[model samples]
Target: MRKTLPLIIFITLTGTMYALGQSAKAIIPLGGNAWVTGKATITDDGLTNWENPQDAISIYFRVDKAAELTFALRVRVPEGKSKISVTIGKHTFSKQVANTGFDTLSIGKVMLQPGYIKVDLKGISRSGNVYADVTDLIVEGVQSANELTYVRTGSSFHFGRRGPSVHLRYNIPQEIKKDVKWFYNEITVPQKMDVIGSYFMADGFSGGYFGMQVNSDTERRVLFSVWSPFNTDDPKSIPDSLRIKLLTKGDKVHGGEFGDEGSGGQSYLLYPWQAGKTYAFLLEAAPDKLYNSTTYTAWFKETGTDKWLLIASFSRPQTFGYLTDLYSFVENFEPDNGDKIRMAYYTNQWLGDSAGKWHAVTGAKYTGDETARKNYRKDYSGGLKDGRLYLRNGGFFDDLTPLNQKLEYRTSLPPPMIDFNQLPR
Candidate 1:
């Protein structure tokens, strides 16, 4: 039976940070869920899940840090004379699998870094053109070989089973109230992943969020919208006067990608995007003419480009007037086959006030979906890697967990708080 879970409690914000150390030794798997290059595909034949590639292929994954590693691969050589060669850095090992069933091959230990590492496999010889088949890669023992860093690539907390995704956020130090003008960040869509959800938002009685997304290989867009304090899903339940609008010319508005749980609006299909490219996004919110109303606006510019295109705007009455949260996340939209690895790099985050002053946001806390926190199902992975935030999810991982950690906790300040009690009945 599926279990119901409560929303995660927000961690207190402060200036203190837990000193993270080197990655401890654990068995890390490189399999269908892992990122690969140079010709590989995942296949399941009713029983086993395996990755097969044409001869001379390489697979990549990150480790917490440098360590002496004992590598293992489950192999199936179709013929008696078939042979395979596996190489890691300067080391190489050869083996012959004369049986039809899968067998294990242990490639002895070697030193490796805590970040990304590539393992190469070559089909040396096989009879009648039969290719050698194998499962995933695994490391047996580990010994830290480098100094502790902020993030580790191959950490277990970063990947998992199939389901909803995870999130990472940096709360702004100053409360972006009715007078604040903007929240900004420069981010890159990570190469080789399928989707990323990013946004700058404020938490209040009525919450508002805006950002860009890479939903699929072909679909990329910038989205902006606001959640009404009302709880009804029916758009008609809310007057047209309260709906969000696209103030900019040449932009399209569409139904929000989020499901029906509240009164929310979205403007999307506004622009096209590419992978591995950086784009700057700015979201502005301030009090409107009404005493308790606020106007929300969004702007975007691709890196190396000068124009900051206006995306959309919406005005909410009887609401908090400032931006409260600056956060981003990675998720899989297509549930059936949607669970594939995807990531995005976020940096240069800044918060802007009505006075035209900007403050830098250099650190943040890591969190995940409530379902993932309650269920042991391993379906997502992500966190701060090499000083930038990254998120990964989908595939066949059954032991992956979410990376949930917060840096400095600031008192006298509160993140945008969602008022569930005030939600429309």
Candidate 2:
């Protein structure tokens, strides 16, 4: 059986103007059934079911023009089953209730042609019993023209049971001489699993430049490895420095032993993360360096090996001063790098210093053995012996020969396979 609450609406000024220079108009009202014995408080915090037997609720509003839309709703289901739905005209978006506590739902850019909008809530019950509560609903109007657009790569990268499609967005700052690359990813999971995703960026001179790793599931441990040129401010210098960081979900995961400091060392930093949590990686690069800032999240589930999936990459480029960010989603990822598991990070580049001196840092290798992956630590570092070196000329701004030295490599000792049922969904 399903029960629903009365319709409620609320509106606030958003300071949005149309092309005609008129303030955009929207209609909203304080939500909930006013006739109820106790007032149903509705705020941005989300919706809650105060009365157990109450039916579902629906809210309606209107937009005068075509625009993008964003909204939030809170729902609480103490027992049984319930769901919230967002309806724009005839199209309805809905999600099933999982947790008994309050859960927040957010919908990204949706095109709203001038029409009526309605959000409906339905109480789900098994054996003719309904158990659920709902409260606050907030809606915001966004301009369609202002939304950032992206190009879909059609190709997808598969990790574990999860598969995430690739999208790329490029931005070139006016002043910087370097390119800032932005790699956008959309990950879809059929089920769920414990998962970790990361990207390695490097030049030849320094061993590896910068590494960013994100763990989507907090309950299980994840192993990460990377090899690159050193880290330096000069674009003309070959990579010679290498640094690696190990991360874990529970306590601090140990990273392998790093080489001596300055030569190419390793460091460990404990990041506050929870099990069954999803996180995003925002990596930025200016003319001379790259770094990470802020993190967004999603929930983690354990399902068959085919359940957990990830879509991520390190291809975005940024101008000298501007920052570029990349995002990844992990759902139902489990750690079971069965035999044939292959993981690797590789890169190559040439740099010319301010002295007009050009040196090529080529043939760099930072490989991790089987033991490294098996006993994965939160903090560790080491060097590879297979790396190379090269030399180039000055006054030459373009040289494909030296720049082409950059390459990436990966070999799975056991090979990667989709082990869906092996995970906890």
Candidate 3:
């Protein structure tokens, strides 16, 4: 009886262990966390229109601890049959799926360490007209699911893939905070960090923003934009009297109106700006009390060049103010390149008071947008480095700066020497 009792206790313990392992489960919606690098696309309904075998879907999620995770996909084969494979690190699992309706099929398991994991799915072969429509990726055996990070369901998939946007808010000296007329800053993208869809904004005020962007593999641009006083996403809905007017622009700069984010006056100069080279941005805000409006001007130039090219000067209606709320930021604008890391170094930040005296910007605070604040994504980082403030986002790096951390520069640099009289009219 004693020997039989010991065996019964052992059996009970083993059964309990198996039950615990089966209970750890998490469902990651592909609509928010997946990216299709090929012709296929992931929409609100999840992955769809996967007609090509070359289409590769990369889904990202982070686990907090090392565990053997079993994966399953809630998917459907709209036509015949397809053989697909999911690759995680060195381990690969294949399955032949023929479910015509939505169902969760187990894709097998792999051992992974704590960090961001990429699940790469591709069609090995398809007997149907198309591949498969996958809606979700499921994982089991994670001890703690709350600590994991990924794009949660019901969030924005387009922005989820774009990752987080990070910023460095400059601390203006108390006396000149409200009367600052000009903001001067510099940016340099280090080698291999000039990623496509990256916008390295140098001057950001309360009313408008100015920056440089990697539009594509063959195109780069210096862009400036001013939000309209009328609050609407469609520019046409804005009354003509409330619209922003272009006062003037430099040669080869395109000045127009833009929408979708916010209705605003947009201008950009297509310059082949290279990485690892310092560039300078200068912005001016002049208020006209007579007309109750403010005029904003921007200029960009290579640090070593003597010439400063004008981006565009815009007159904003229904506003009267100098530059307020100065800051700098870095963001990934393209959902396709959000998985890649990008960074920008901002230095020599200085602002001019109404009296034309420049004050050194010595302090700043790191902040992120709603995506970072809600913790939907955790790949953003910002801090002081080499006496300069750097902003980094995307690539799913493990180090994320705490939101709203105040920072001060350790090195003092000379204020930029500029002859106001020589600036282009």
Candidate 4:
């Protein structure tokens, strides 16, 4: 037999790829009570390990589903390098630090999937000495789904008649696929009701209107409003007066007055809508001639009370010769608090044909609160109820009857809550 030379087999792996070393796929625990073993190399030469080699850090964790991640960090830089790099998965995010003593560093948004996730922190200094410290770290949107929801109260007269319009818009992340739904309660104002003109039926009005929109594409905008006529001279035609109301749950407790009359004008309440969820709405209106000329519109929301608070109002004259005569007076406007508020309006336009020479007036009001101010993005953003264009037995309204007018409304589901327990240690 010929002697075959024994062949020697040798395999070599380097860095984090060695068989005897930790596998790149291995899960590592970090943060709050997690165990890790690697001696940090420290040096004062302002070169070797940079600043204090002891500052380099690493974290590991697993996710149950793919998600959008955000990290909020407060950092302090002493005097070396102005750049810091964060390594996660196969991507690296770098941030530039101002030479200032303290600053906020955001890692922005990152898409992450289920499995082991490792984050490596590396800082580089100018003279070779990098010094920095991370005080807080917050990761959001992992192991959770997005949802949205809304609630409305009140009703609108002339069921099919399109009234005023309210619009809403939001920015959505690309990672989520969501389902949406809308809910509402249409109420009718009772005869001889004690409530103000255009107020809710339960509060005693002749007609009412309410509706909401939900889960709208963050890229697309959503609108809600009551539709009515702009001219009333032809009693055989729809009238042109529109009114709305505003209230808040916190008003009474805060010693704020509630009504449709004042120099502060009308008020409006606001709410923050989550990216994915369902919402419900209620719209109400009444057109009785005896009290119909008094147009009333307001916005209200819960502020830790059972009853809605009046935060904004939209009221104007119903029998004006010109649409330009309509104007809105807003008051008590704030824009910081987050919550969807309610709005109400009244009009005699429903008299349809009985009223003549319709003059449309459109106005907006804000409750003087931090939240309402933040929402509309203006000291006030409404004007006298004005007709964009007059329609005299025209296209969409030619054969339209108060009972046959088209009415549209919308709302959505609630957003998903994040699971803090599943976060990387």
Candidate 5:
């Protein structure tokens, strides 16, 4: 018993640490301090054992149920036993690793429970250098897989090597209505995404944006606003005849005198939105009869509801005419402060004109801000998966070279068919 006293103590400590870690939530990279023993040192790039004979890194995670788990990792082990040992509770999986360069490894089918599960990656008993470098760790095949897939998260500050904070957009290919009157789209918000960006926008930022967002953990709101061609912080500075007017703001909508991105305009907020539910937005734009202004009206109807409630209506006296560009984007606004992943689903996009006919928007491409393209080593990723366009940018990486998969011009549908008479005003 005396001879095995040290072994028992080590086991007890490891189990205790892992239990504590499992109780909380964290994203543990190799360089983070979630280890239990073995004196493992992790550089900015990876975890390696240069002096110690025994080394290990331990992390804990929680799951809602007993299901299959996948471990996605970039690893390299050269001239050692050529293997790494992974421990979950009492089960162990010995996986063969590459000898050089990083390779993505998938180790899965590990049974997990509805509570805390500790994973231990330990060095094998061998003669050569025992080392492994990990980059990405993803847990899939869960009860909330749909919600999890939409989590938008990445490194935010890339030491001035950051990607453009832009949107994943789809234009109507060609202008359908010379004088447009209506635009429509259906959107669904994921249940647990901490932040929901302006997922839907008309005419991009130059024109304006209408979106549903979780501004903060507790604040859920629908945001709608348009940009003013004039540059001024004071809303009153613009002449009353030239400034935009909020014709009507729906119940619970509250906003006035907002400014950002070198443009000053108006905004409205509506609250108590439901997650995991579909919501439809119908936008109407027409020139005001009395003034040389254009009125934009937003109508919203939640799924399972009968009547469309008018959200807000604003008229821009200086700007007039149709929706020039339309698209959607996903982003992590507080990437540096929060670990909450967010995702928005955009579908059933449609457009209309004065003729009272609606056309579907069929094609879109993957593109990022010019800043990211200029430093396009590994800061942005935009592409299509399962007919859906996605944009993922910014993440912490020691060597961001592997994030260099930039795909463009991913069209989802055939050319859009536009046939509508210009409805008379």
Candidate 6:
């Protein structure tokens, strides 16, 4: 079932926010949904970083019906008159404003079908220090019999702009339900889909994630991390007994602590992994019920390579269980690159039992985070493609995969043949 956020339309005025249900006019804060190019940026008060006419901004929203939608903008000229334009598809609306104070400027209307819509806002002509500082997009015409989806105000705009993170929850067969000791998966990101800031997570369990990332133009990484048994997000606050103790790391890999999204022991190798090449990830969990602890180790390598370079190993003090809640995911860790679309194909998933037998994964469930569930930035989809489970997000695409949609690859992929004893310690 698609878990959609309630029909809570937000209206921001005088630095305050209020929610209304299917109102005549709903405010879509640019701070939450705008993707800026050039020198333009998003601020707490909205689009205040715009200072150049050459800069461009894109605002995305999804409408669920074919309707004539009216548009308006809340903006400030600061000094003199400025002319700005809002373009949607083939329709463009331009208006002139000279309001020193923030005021609403109507930007005409358009007939739109049911899908994701992009509103391109740019400066046309201005006689001020900067172009219009736009704050919000006020939309009407969808009230009683229509549905609309956009990132709402009064929340963290960073996550809103970074868009939704989707996951593939792999279904481990019931026969291997108890002592699944290892998880193995492969990821192949398509060419041109390797947008910066994308983390194509290949292996994710209840306690940690292992993946490859397009860190920046000059950097790529094979990253791995495991959470501490403590519940705090601050790594420094975790008690030594409950903290994730680093066992070892590979040569040239940086090992340290990470925080803010569940503090954990972090390690990464600065490898220039490229798109279009399949990379392999293997994660192992060894639980000791007597000591109430579990040790997790991660390894990554190219598919054709004979070596599995160990990423890192961590021992969580308060947990004692085999790997459960297995999954893989695709997410944008950096909000600045959220406008660009990225995707990856996860294939040949297998689980290794305690008896050293490999089980082929046949089923998975596609899901999204709070962003997609709340209907904020709906450009996310996932399903089985060519014997592989693929996940996609961003780019403002119209296609949507159903939330919790079950995806299965019926063909039997070749299971991995590994000498477990020869793995790096």
What Cα-based lDDT does every candidate model obtain?
0.53, 0.29, 0.87, 0.28, 0.52, 0.86
The residue-by-residue lDDT of candidate 4 on 1-425, one tens digit each, is 99665323222231101121211111111221011123332111111223543455554343445666665445556665567777776788888765545555777767876543456667654433444544334354432211100000111111101122221111111221111011111211123211111112111111112222222223111112222223222222332333232222223222112222111122223333222222222212222356444333322222122333232222333422111111111111111101112232222111101122111111112122221222211111211123211111101111211211222211121212212223111
**Which sections of candidate 2 miss by over 4 Å?**
1-56, 107-109, 124-131, 140-425
Estimate, for each residue in 307-420, the C-alpha lDDT of model 3 and write its tens digit.
999999999998998998888999998887888999999988888988889998878899999889987788899998777789999998887788899997733777888998
TM per prediction: 0.54, 0.22, 0.90, 0.23, 0.53, 0.93
**Candidate 2 local lDDT, 1-425, one digit each (tens):** 88675323322233222222222222122231111223332333223333433443444333446776656554556776655455554566665655577666553346666533445554434321333455444445533322211111111111211211111111222332222221111121112211254221221111222222344444223322222234443323424222322222212433443332222223223343332333221122223345431111111222222343221112112212322321111111222111111122121222222222222222232322221222111012222224412121111112112111222322212212323234221
Between candidates 4 and 6, the one scoring higher on TM-score is 6
What is the descending TM-score order?
A: 6, 3, 1, 5, 4, 2
lDDT-sorted candidate list, best first:
3, 6, 1, 5, 2, 4
Q: Find the 10 residues in a row with the least total lDDT in model 3.
A: 7-16
Q: State the local distance difference test value for candidate 6.
A: 0.86
| Model 2, TM vs. native | 0.22
lDDT of candidate 1 over 4-100, digit per residue (tens): 6543322213211112232223232333233333344433211122223343555444455566766777666555556777888888888775768
Candidate 4's TM-score: 0.23
For candidate 6, lDDT tens digit of each residue in 1-425? 99866767664453333445645566788888788888987875688756787888998888888989888889888998888888987998888889999999888889999998889988888888888788998887776422777777677788988889999998889998978998999999999999999999999999999999988899999999999878888999998888888889999999999999989899999999988899989999999788899999998889988998989988989899899999989999899888889999998899999888989887999999999987777899999877678999988888888799887664376788788899887
Alpha-carbon runs more than 4 Å astray in model 1: 1-162, 174-179, 195-206, 215-217, 240-242, 245-259, 289-291, 397-402, 408-425
Q: Could you give the C-alpha RMSD of every candidate to the true structure, in order shown?
A: 12.6, 23.2, 5.8, 23.5, 16.3, 4.7
Q: Where is model 3 more than 4 Å wrong at Cα?
A: 1-24, 51-53, 143-145
TM value for model 1: 0.54
Q: What is the lDDT of candidate 5?
A: 0.52
Better of 3 and 6 by lDDT: 3
**Candidate with best lDDT:** 3
- In TM-score terms, which candidate is top? 6
